[model samples]
Target: MRQYQAVEETGMSINKKIRHIENTIVLSPSFKQAIAMIRECHERSKLTTEPKCMLLIGNTGYGKTTIANHYVGQYARVVSKDGTTVPVFYSMIPSNATIKGLACRLLEDLGDPLYDRGTTINMTSRLCRLIKECKVELIILDEFQHLIDRDSDRVLRSTADWLKDVLNRTKVPIVLMGMPNANSILTVNPQLMRRFANICELKAFNWNPVKERDDFLRFLIMIEKATFFPQPSILHSNEIALRIFCATKGVVSYIKKLISKAAEIAYVKNLDRVTTEALALAYNDELALSNTMSNPFLVDHENLNIPSLEQSFHNSSDAARHGGKRRVAEILRR
Candidate 1:
């Protein structure tokens, strides 16, 4: 029997299966490691005089947010007659965020009634008080890269200093996460960097058989187990696997997108199973790369120009530099 299989043979309504696909999280090894590291920092902060901070850097679409959310869920808050105890607090750093703006956001998440009405110092004080009052052991701030100057990519010194003060006050483990460029935020702030000196980098999944293929296959199987697929184990087959790898370039979010869309197509059309054509339609509809020779599902593997795995990461700057649809297209054409 397949692992974690739900009902047998289309037990769910077509819509439910499609919905389940979006919820399915395949916990690959790297994902588990990153979560473990974050948990350790959370636990460590409990005993330290100084707060422990960690920086998690990964490419876009690599599931950093998912990890943050999963970590929060794992250590969910408890409520009782004594009071509500929030073990973990998660918030996203807004684009062009000010220290006051950021503090208000955190305060809002912590249930402060007047989230937007305080001065910068007042809000930070209230935010820190709430963090301690609620007994929050960990604070997770996502989108850390937005802390840098977009033009120069330099860390915003004033905001960085403000964040350092919050950690000093709260004395709770804090996880800062963003795309790989977020490292630029740290490089410019030595003090802040030292505070979060222990860093974890999550790289994209590689397709080379010698290094990462087995893990990728296992990931697909795990996704299979999480849902009642019309057919099973078809994703890990060599042919479909190759198509998936080429289509998604081993990015977790893209893989999920392809699978979810293909499953949606299969169910809507009453297909016996997810087929290359379904994946082709899914890829075209969702990825916006259809009709071009680059669509992995539409072309012969031999004919498709798969870019170097290292070049697979998509970013705005890279896209602008390379021009057109994206760098992947440029890489494929070479």
Candidate 2:
């Protein structure tokens, strides 16, 4: 019997199967390493001395925030005689964030309802007291890149300095996660850079080189195993692997999105397996890449202009923003 049939025989509902497919976390090697590092930092924070900080840098949709959330979830809050003890606190740095704004956000995350009304000094003091009281071992600042202000050097520098002060006061480890450009925030601030000397980068998969290709293929197999359909998908096939890579550019988020959408399409159409045609439809629906000539899954491999196709994929958002005018221009020129 097919995998989906077996699952259905065991009384698994279609919605449950689809939920499993959507929630699957295929932990790559880098994800495992990052989790380990987070644990190490948490352990180090128990010591009386100041804990070393970590900066996690990655491109958008590269799983930085997901990994952070995963690690923090592992150390969820515990109740003690004093109050609720949150081992790890997670907060997102708001866009155009200032020192006071960040302090208020952190306070709010720690359960201070009136955090928004306090002065910077009052908020900082209250935050430090709450951290100690709640026994927060680690602080994870997601979208740390937002702390940087391109227009105001003073605000940027002050924000970094404020972070340094928070670390000094709390004596807890902090993990800063954001896109690659966030690294510039550290480079410009010597003190902050020195404090967060340890950095971990989560990078997208690459197609070139034999090992990377093999790893990518293995990842495809993992995805296939995780997905449930009436019949097995040929995602592990060599041709499909190339097509998937071309469509997603080896980004894990994009790969998951493509597979999930394809599975949904198969279910809706009463298709037995996820086919190249289904993938093309998913790409069109999810990513808005409708040009059959540019779609790797729809075209002959030898005729595929990979560089041009990648450029088009990158520009897909811009094309949508401008109402596909640029996309039409490119197609007509071609």
| Highest TM-score scorer | 1
TM-score of candidate 1 against the unseen true structure: 0.86
Per-residue lDDT for 66 in model 2?
Answer: 90
Consecutive 10-residue window with the lowest summed lDDT within model 2: 325-334
lDDT (10s digit) by residue, model 1, range 1-334: 3312333354687678877888988789899999989988988877888877899989989999999988898877887888778989899987767788788888888888899996898888898888888999889999988888777766777887899888887788789999887887777888888999888898776666435877887888776665565456388876777678777878898889888888778666666567788898889888755334478877764555455543443344565466334544443333
CA-lDDT, candidates in order: 0.78, 0.78
Model 1 lDDT, full chain set: 0.78
**Model 1 steric clash pairs:** none
- Candidate 1, residue 149: Cα displacement in angstroms equals 3.4
Error of model 1, residue 120, in angstroms: 1.3
Worst 10 residues of 1 by lDDT: 1-10
lDDT accuracy of residue 166 in candidate 2: 86
Q: List the residue pairs that clash in candidate 2.
A: none
Candidate 2 lDDT, 1-334, residue by residue in tens: 3544544553556677678777888777788889888787878768648697899999989999899889877887887667889888999998878888888888888888798977898889999999998888889999988877756633377888888998998888999999888888888888888888889998777655557666777787788776665567879676687778778878888998898888777766666678889998888887655233477677665544445344654666765565434543443233
Provide TM-scores for the models.
Answer: 0.86, 0.85
